[model samples]
Target: MAKISAAEVNKLRKATGAGMMDCKKALVEAEGDFDSAIEILRKKGQKVAAKRADRDSSEGAAIAVVNADANKGVVISLNCETDFVAKNDDFVALANDFAQLALNCTSKEELLAADYKGITVEEKL
Candidate 1:
């Protein structure tokens, strides 16, 4: 195995927001290749997501928003695995943004397909 330095691990951590240990392990597994390490980390996230797919996500926030005209309104629910995460400021902000997006959507499918920033609403979640 090639030597993986602390600098490389830190770099990957900053780029991916993954844990220090996870980044180091990925760098080692990828033989110090940054891109491959990112792919490895992303795959790990996917695996974890798949494993948790069946878990209940009953804790979250419901948000409602009205357009400037006051004639249009939208409401949405964003679910999370834990109350700690559900109450996070970023989580609430994202729910609000989704509600705002919902005002423009004609259906659930359109809401999911709508763009949030640069990514789709489904992808953002």
Candidate 2:
């Protein structure tokens, strides 16, 4: 496989909104083909973000994640019904859980279907 360069990975990240490492891996897996790498990310559910697509989310708090090396990070937001809901313990916990889930999830549906606590993602949502 061809080695993917940082510039190419950054380009893919800009185009797909995926993380740097994900983009790099996808690029390497696709032999440095930008569109193919994009397809790879999409299959992994990272190319398109489903949570961000929900137009119904009008209010929420933002979240971020720093890698183990603390050199890179990702940020996201959880939309809620109100400030009171945002302040609720359950809601805060849910947001934290989903943020971690997003690190591996690419689409909203898969994220919604992921395991959480003892319940299925669908049940939690």
Q: Per-residue lDDT tens digits of candidate 1, residues 22-53?
A: 99999999998999998899789878878999
TM-score of each: 0.71, 0.44
Report, for every candidate in turn, its global Cα lDDT versus the true structure: 0.90, 0.75
Please give the distance, in angstroms, between residue 63's alpha carbon in candidate 2 and its true position after superposition: 1.2
Per-residue lDDT of model 2, residues 41-96, tens digit only: 87777224454455455667788876678766557677765688778776777777
C-alpha RMSD (angstroms) for model 1 = 3.1
Q: Model 1 Cα displacement at 123 (Å)?
A: 2.0
What lDDT score is found at residue 109 in candidate 1?
95
Q: Residue 53 of model 2: what lDDT?
A: 53
